[model samples]
Target: MASYELNAFDRRFQSISLVGAIEQVSPYTLNVGYWLRDPNQLILYPDLVASHPRLDFLWEKTCFEIFIGVQGEDYYREINLSPSQAWQAYQFEEYRYPETMPPQVAYDIELNQLKRTHYGLNVSLDLTEFMLAHKLKWSDLFIGLTAVLETSQAQQFYAMQHSGQNADFHNKRDWLHIF
Candidate 1:
C-alpha cells in the first residue's frame, strides 16, 4: 500500500487534511481508500457532508477521485468515489478529453465513518478488465489522486499538487507522480 497526504488549495481549510492510499490487491484488481482527517473536532459545524448511493456528479460535493493511466501514454481513466458509496468512471484518450471506448464499469463501494471525525471510502477496481478494455497491457502505471470538499460554509479542492490558481484537480500537474 502506498499512502498520500494532500493539502487544500486554499489555506482557510487548514484543519482538514486528505489522506489516501492505493493497494494493488492483484494483477486484475486495485483497492483505493480516501480518508478525510479533521483533528480540530469541528464535526458539528457546517454539517453539509453526507453519504448515499448516487450515480453521477459526485464531484459537486465532497468526493474522492482517482486518475490513472499507463506510463508514457496519453490514455487514462478518471474514477469518482464518493463517501456515499457512489462511483463514476470515465476514459480519456489524452489529457482531459473524453474517450468513448469501453463502457463504464460499476463496482461496489465501501464506506466507513470512523468516530464522526474521519471519513473512509474504499473501492476496488478490476484493473485487468480496464487494461484490456483500453488495450493497455504490461505497462507501468501513473496515477493522480484528488478530492472536492463542500461544507455548509465553504467548498474546497485538494490534490497532490495545485495545478493552477483556479484550483482544477483534473490537471495532470495536480496529480501525484507515478507510483
Candidate 2:
C-alpha cells in the first residue's frame, strides 16, 4: 500500500510505494514488503517555506499529514495499519514537481521567484514497491487530486468519509446490504 499528505492551500504532495503482502483475511491488511524507488530522488522546494520567518523555521520539522491505501477500481481506500505495523514494513520516499530549476539565485528576480515555487507533493514512493507488492512485473502509480464529484451532497459526503475513517471502501453505504 501507499500513502501521502498535502496541505490544503499548498500545492505540494508526496506518495510512497511499498512491496508487501495483503493479509485480507485474518488481519485484513496490507503490508509493505519493500520500497522500489530511491529516497534521494525525493526533493522539497523552498517555497513550501511559510512566508513568516518563524514559520519558515518549522518547514524541516513539519510532518506532512498522510492518508494511505491502495487504489481500487473506482476509488482509493485507506490501509488500516497500526503504527507498529508501519514500522515493520519496508518503505522509501519519492518526490515530484518543478520541471526545471536554475543553477544560481542571481540576476533575475522573476527566476528567483520561480525557484521558490513548488507545485506538487514534497515526497512520493518509488514505483517499484507497487509492482513487487502486487506480484506484477510492471505497474504504474499516479498521485493527484480529485477535481469533480457527482453531486454537491455527494462531494461533501465523501469528503467527510475520507477525512474521518480508514476503510476499504470509499462509501460505506455502498457496501451495506439493504433488506
Candidate 3:
C-alpha cells in the first residue's frame, strides 16, 4: 500500500490532514482507503441508506474521490465515494471529457464515521475488469486521490497536489503514480 498525505487547496484545511492507502488486493480487485481527521471540523452531508445512482455529482458537498489510469495515458477513470456510501464512477477519454463506460461492472464501498475524531471510507472495485475493458491492467498505474470538504461557511478542496492556483483536482499534473 502506498500512503499519501494531501494538501489543502485552501489554507483553511491547515488543521485538517487527509491520509490514505492504495493497493492491489488481488489481480482482479483494487482496495483503497482514506481517512479524514477531525470530522467535526467540516460540515458533511447526511448519510444515505443505500447506494446512490451513478453520475451523481456527490463532490458538490462532502465526498472522497479517486482517479486511476495507466501511466502517461490521457484517458482515465474517476470514482466518487461519499460518507453515505453512495458512489459514481466515470471514464474520461480526456480531461473533463467523458467516454462510454462498460455496460456492467462491480463497484463497492463501505463508509463509516468514527465518533468525533475521524471519518473513514473503504472501497473495493473490479479494477482489473475495468482495465481490461479499457485495454489491460498495465504494470504501471497512476492515481489522483482527492476529497471535497464542506464547512458551514464554505466548501474546500484537498488533493495529492494543488493545481489551477485554485482547487482544480482535475489537473493531470497533480496525479500521483502508483504501481
Candidate 4:
C-alpha cells in the first residue's frame, strides 16, 4: 500500500487535510481510500443518490479523482467519484485531448464515514478490461490521486503534487505512484 498526503494548491485551506491511500488487491483490482479532515465542514458535499449512478461533471462540485497512465505514454484514463454516489471515467489520448473514450472497468464506491468534521470513501476498481484494451500490466502503470473541495467561497484543488502554475490535474508529471 502507498499513502500520500495531498497538497492543496490554495494555502488558505491549510486547516483541511486530504490523505489518499492506494493498494493493489490483485493483479487487476485496485483499492483506494480518501479521508478528508475538515473540522469546520468547510467543504460542500452532495447528497448521496440511492442508485449511485455514473455521471459526468462530478468535478464541478467536491469530488475525488484518479488518473491511470502507462509508463512513458501519453494516453491515460481518468476516473471521478462524488459523495453524491455519482461517478465518471474517461480515456484521454494526451493532455486532455481526444475529449473522451468510454472507460472499460467496473468500480464500487463505499462511504466509509461522513460527519461534520470528517469524510471518508473507499473505492474498488477492477481494471481487467482496461488493462487489456490498453495492452498494459500492473507494473506498467502509474496512478495519480486528486480531489476538488468546493466551499461557498471557492474551490480548492488537491493532488499528490502540483506541477503547473494552475492546479492542472491532467498533467502526467503529477502522477507519481508507480503501480
Candidate 5:
C-alpha cells in the first residue's frame, strides 16, 4: 500500500488534512482510502446512500478521484468516488477528449464505508481483462489520486502534486504512483 498526503490547491482550508491511499488487493481488486482530519467539521458532505450508483459530475461536490494511465500512452481511465455513495468512471482518448460515453468496461465499487472522518472505497476492475483489452500490464500503469472538498464557503481541490498554475487534476504529469 502507498499513502500520500494530498495538498490543497486553495489555502483556505488549512485546518483540515486529507490523505489518500491506494493498494492493489488482488489481480482484479483495487482499494482506495481517504481520511479527512477536520476537527471542526469544515467540509460539507452529501448524505450517504445504502446503494451506490454510477453518476456523472461527482466532482461538483466532495468527491475522491483516481486517474489510471499507461506509462507511455496518452489514453487513461478516471474514477470518481463520492462520499454520497455516487461514483463515475471514464476512459479518455487523450486529455479531455472523447468523453462522450462511459468506459467499455465498467469499474464497480465493491465495498464502501463512509464515516464521520474517514471514507474507504474498494473498487474492482479486472486487471487481467483490462490488460488484455488495452494491451498493457500492471507495470505499465501509473496513478493519480485527488479529491474535491466542498466547504461551507467554497470548494477546494486536492492532489498529490499540482504541476500547472491551476489545479488541474486531469494533468497526467502529476500522476506519480505506479500500479
Candidate 6:
C-alpha cells in the first residue's frame, strides 16, 4: 500500500512510497488509488459536493473511490469528486507574465498600415518577421515618424489655444520672448 501526507491549510502535498508492488490495471483486475470504508456506500469530499455542478452524474457513473483495508479491518475511506474537483484542494494562484513595452518604432501608423495592407496584414507581422521573410535589417522609420507627428501636433494645438497671456510672465519683453 502507498502512503501520502496532505496539508490542507498550507496546501502542501507529499507522496510516500507504497509497500506492495503497484498493481497494473487489466481487463479482470481493478487498480484503485484510494481506499473506501464501505462497499455499498460512497464517500465524497465536502468541497466537491458544494462546488461541482456534475458531481451527481460522475458519482453515479464511475467507480471513483477505492475500497482498501486489511481483510478483517473495519475502517475504510473513499474519495469522490468530479474530475474538476480532483485537484481543487491544491489550487494555486495563476502566474502571469510581466508586462513589456512594445518597440518605440512600432507606433508608426503609416508603416503599420502599409505592412498590414501590403505585406503581413496584421499587427503580428513585426520587424522580426519582416526581416526573416525579406532579409532586411532593423528599421525604426515608423517610430521616428510617429514621434515627430505627435510633437508637431502638440505644438500646433498649444499655439492655437494658448495666446501666452498667462500672469506668470506679465513683462512685455518676457512675454514676447516667451511667445
TM-scores, in order shown? 0.76, 0.21, 0.81, 0.87, 0.85, 0.17
Candidate 4 regions exceeding 4 Å error are: 100-118
Q: Report the error of model 4 at residue 58, Å.
A: 0.5
As a TM-score, model 2 comes out at 0.21
User: What lDDT tens digits, residue by residue, belong to model 1 across residues 56-81?
Assistant: 67677777788886777776777877
Sorted by TM-score (best first), the order is 4, 5, 3, 1, 2, 6
Each model's total of backbone clashes: 1, 12, 0, 0, 0, 4
Q: After superposition, how far is residue 74 of candidate 2 from its true place, in Å?
A: 18
Q: Write the residue-wise lDDT of candidate 3 on 1-179 in tens digits.
A: 88898888877557667887787776667777887775456565646645444547678778888887667678777787777667777667677774333312234222222121235777776665566665666475788899887767677788888857777777878887567
lDDT by residue (92-117, candidate 6, tens digit) is 11111121221111111111111111
Instruction: Show where candidate 2 strays beyond 4 Å.
Output: 1-61, 71-121, 136-179
- Candidate 1 residue runs with Cα over 4 Å from true position: 40-54, 99-118, 134-139
User: Compared with the true structure, what per-residue lDDT tens digits does model 4 show for residues 20-129?
Assistant: 99898867788888988887778888887766567777888999998988888887888888877677777776788875444443343222222222357778777777
Better of 3 and 5 by lDDT: 5
Which pairs clash in model 3?
Answer: none
Name the runs in model 3 displaced over 4 angstroms: 51-55, 99-118
Worst 10 residues of 3 by lDDT: 108-117
In candidate 5, stretches whose alpha carbon ends up further than 4 angstroms from where it belongs are 99-128
lDDT on C-alpha atoms for all candidate structures: 0.66, 0.22, 0.69, 0.80, 0.75, 0.19
Which of 2 and 6 is ahead in TM-score?
2
Q: What TM-score does structure 4 among the candidates reach? A: 0.87
Model 1 gets an lDDT of 0.66
